[model samples]
Target: PLQVKRGIIDKQTGKIAGEEEYYVDRDECNRADTTLAGLLKLPPVFDTTSGQGSVTAGNSSQLSDGASATLLMSRERAEALGVRPKLVFRGYAVAGCEPDEMGIGPVFAVPKLLQRHGLRVEDIDLWELNEAFASQVVYCRDRLGLDPEKLNVNGGSISIGHPFGMTGSRLVGTLANEMLRRKARLGVVTMCIGGGQGMAGLFEACL
Candidate 1:
């Protein structure tokens, strides 16, 4: 559900934070066509439609000319620079998987990360699992027993175009902002990499 600051909602953003419902206003959307009819007229990325197969243009992440960056430094360095940090990187883990099943990478990586920190799935306050695909996100949620309520409260890569190399920066930046807004203690940024691997990074609120 959208946590609307105003009681009224319509022509605002969306009712549910998902891939399809997200709106691309004015200059944000660089797609050839933004209309529903134009989108429907386009062919699926795969041989089958969404009803037949999980892969579709709607659920897939597209590469765009997008960029995001974050300043990273040790606690001492931050202190020396007089820069108070907003979060601390607790742990990160990467796990291998079949190339074809790469989307399931988080299922393995998340456990390793949490286990290393003596934490559990339930202990996580928020998650920014990249929406590489709906199928993968759904699988990771069920396999890892993640709470949907605590998952991607906002739409993900599917809604926001996925810019390849900047995904880490983008996800982490978004995670940090949301964590601060919600006052969440633990937040995770995770995604499945191409060539059969999944990566997850755990973070804790510092300030």
Candidate 2:
């Protein structure tokens, strides 16, 4: 979520807020086709669709969306200015699943993250699994030991709306805000996509 506020902001542009934007446009169309062709340089799909020849560019899609944020300084820096920040960020990770089985992404991702941090499933205080589908969340809970009670506390896409390209960033904003609201130290955000792909990210609230 982004805001248009009336205020004098202070900060150098050098500081990077965690958010980033990635867009694909017409320039990428030929690259996409060429890349597919090269990968066809191998076997399997190439063996099947042999001699499809160098792929040609086709129609492209245009999409646009908005998102921005507020950055928090360290506790010491905030206190120095007599301002206290509410939340701190911890870590983030993303995973991919087969588009068809996209729903299972979190199941694979959650354990990977826990192992990476040497934490257990129980250590996660909250979760904000994107409700790409009712079954995605349902399946994740049963497989990842996620407590349903601690999942998606503020209602999700099912209630709001799904804005394609915008969903990822939106989930990050929502999960971070909700973690602060709930006084949770750690929270996870996961999303499943069409074509059996998915991603999950974990964050820690700042002290």
Candidate 3:
């Protein structure tokens, strides 16, 4: 599923260059160390009760190895280099949250972001909220009243794989590309950090 999505995006942008083997595969699924099946069978990290623990390998992000890069340059520089720009970096915000409830990072970060830019949630055309965990995504979506249709249309970390440090850039790249493809105006990319922090950035698709 993810490979097909990447293929389509690669065709559209030609930025990804080519496919990589980091994506999950049948051979990797058969291996004990790298398999999602093996991870799902282990004891619960938080709650032990059946179907009670909110965090699980199935719902949580996969620990995969990958890398992504986003080229940030001024319009003048890009034009001088004869390259087409995709999106304009509007603004960004960072907010701290309780370490225990770190998953709720976006809940606080997003408001600060909007207020700083003097914009409302409805002003944004698309949103990419990292699926670090299913619980976190659900909580943010309900609390923020995000439209399902405007969110992560091509799936997220849970479906593809979270490469930890690479996820922020990955989200930004995905949002920019999708915004351009849809001819949308505004887009936002937000993610919850590991140690009680959230970061968000807003962008405008270049037409």
Candidate 4:
């Protein structure tokens, strides 16, 4: 069984991220919680493997159609255009893992990104770890010592379907808005790639 997690929790305002897109698909949209009774009813998506394979459709991110976009340019350029900046691109890092066990990509990538900036998990004020699957997300959460309080304060891909091309930018968009509302400093958006790779980026809200 996996921890049923959906919706981001805004630490500063104590609000839950519940956009209409959170449950775009009709499959069990906002249907159940972490109750054992509720979990027992979710259907398994994959067959039982030797040591792993506990993922179920309920705990997995839904595949659906979506799109997101962000404009990246210099602050001077934005100012010249009278456009308000949202975030600053601080740094980025990527790492590889076993393709079959790609869920742990963030586990390796985030640490490298953090070390690059001489930061620790505690230094991050917010996180958007894509919920590709409950299995890998949980593994990263525990392994990275990420604060559940700051992680995915709004609904993640588990709630809203993941659009591969735009997910990373989408996460940065979500993080940028939340960080501004919360008036927070550092936020990190990390997710495991479909293949055996993992990527993470460091961002600072332009406040």
My TM-score estimates for the predictions, one after another, are 0.77, 0.57, 0.77, 0.80
True-structure lDDT of candidate 1: 0.81
How good is model 3 by TM-score?
0.77
Segments of candidate 2 deviating more than 4 angstroms: 1-87
Minimum summed lDDT over a 10-residue window in model 3 is located at 22-31
* Model 3 CA deviation exceeding 4 Å by range: 1-45
Model 2 scores worst on lDDT over the 10 consecutive residues at 55-64
- Angstrom error at residue 147, model 4: 0.5
Expressed as tens digits, the lDDT of each residue in 7-107 for candidate 3 is: 32366676766654444453221234456666667665578767677676667776776679999999889999999888899899999998988888888
Q: Count of backbone clashes for each model? A: 0, 11, 0, 6
Off by over 4 Å in 1: 1-44, 47-51
The root-mean-square deviation over C-alpha atoms between each candidate and the true structure, in angstroms, is 10.7, 13.6, 9.0, 10.8
lDDT of 4 by residue, 137-159 (tens): 78899999998899888777777
Which candidate should be chosen as best, given TM-score against the real structure?
A: 4
| Best model number under lDDT | 4
Task: Give the CA lDDT, 0 to 100, for residue 188 in model 2.
Answer: 75
* Best of the two (3, 4) by lDDT: 4
